[model samples]
Target: MTSSPTRQRGSKELWLDAAYEMLVSDGIDAVKVMALAKKLNQSRTGFYWFFADLNALHIAMIQRWENQNTQNLVDRCKADATNICTGLFNLMDCWLDPSLFDARLDLAIRNWARVDADLEARLSAADRVRIEAVAGMFRHHGFCDEQAQVRGLTVIYTQIGYISMQVAETRQDRLARVPHYVELFSGINPSPHEVARFLARHV
Candidate 1:
């Protein structure tokens, strides 16, 4: 009979995936090395092979957020010349999607940063990157630089408000109203065809 893989054989990717799973499901407090090891059916030594400590894993999670989520949105907007508004709308959609948004993990990081100045600074830098990228996309879509900055701020604030309201309302209720808010902010009603054509150039 073939032998099953052992904990000692676990790879770095395996550990990272396990960490992410725990983060999404249970929050930062549950991201202990022992908890991860138990989740993965591995030993503490297995975790040590990939991360020096729980803090290292937390840092990796933050870095992954920056690369996978943040960079992807920024790049998507940067790539398309016509779909700036569509892309921004799509971003808000994705952010509110329960399958996509890890509320527990996000809250944990934000709360942790309250006690760590360095982490607060790092997170602030990350927020600036997202803000600037959104502003650039607005400018590309025909708004002047100053106008784009204001629009971008509007988009960001609207998204923040949506997230805050989500706690008190159902996701379906919030999503149903997104278009109205979007229309009020964007002003021009570009057809879906225009957005598709715009996005096609980047693809």
Candidate 2:
């Protein structure tokens, strides 16, 4: 059989993408250089031509994830015209959708980081980026800096906790309970007007 054409991504970009997929689907242990090369239908030579080794690839993956996903989200929030709650809710909706690259990879990385110190540090850095973005949004919505920071951490942590808890729950069950959780997090009694306003601003 003829060989598959050498996959063409910039040297750095290709490895980053491969590492991201491996980490997401399997975990950090899945990100071997040879494995990545095989996944790309290439030889180890292809990987070596770019990265010095697997550790180098891992570092590049962490940096690329931070720049592209974490930083990008922060930038979007900074630019959003919606109020803090609306912007944050929109963010949560995006995170819960598996189709989004950032969210899918984030879930994978978070899972992997649970047992790996280096991975945990990378994940923590990304989390701080998100927390700061949320805090800025809250400040824009009339919260003082210190209060916004606290509220932002609470909102972010609550969202993460909810998702983690729902990992084994039926989608229907999770969907049914989302509003209740949202209400609790937002500290607002359930009301059609408030939800309408939230959707109008966010959706």
lDDT for each candidate structure: 0.66, 0.68
Q: Candidate 2, which ten residues in sequence have the lowest lDDT sum?
A: 92-101
lDDT of 2 by residue, 9-55 (tens): 23657777878888877888889977887887677887877888887
Kindly give the stretch of ten consecutive residues in candidate 1 with the minimal lDDT sum. 194-203
Error of 2 at 109 (Å): 2.2
lDDT of 1 by residue, 1-203 (tens): 64345546487888888877776666666778888788878888878877888778878888876676567657655664445557566555445543444444455556666777977887677667767877887777788988888877787666555444546766566555555665666776657665454344333
Give model 2's TM-score versus the native structure: 0.71
Candidate that scores best on lDDT: 2
Badly placed stretches (over 4 Å) of model 2 are 1-14, 96-101, 114-116, 166-183, 188-203
TM-score of each: 0.76, 0.71
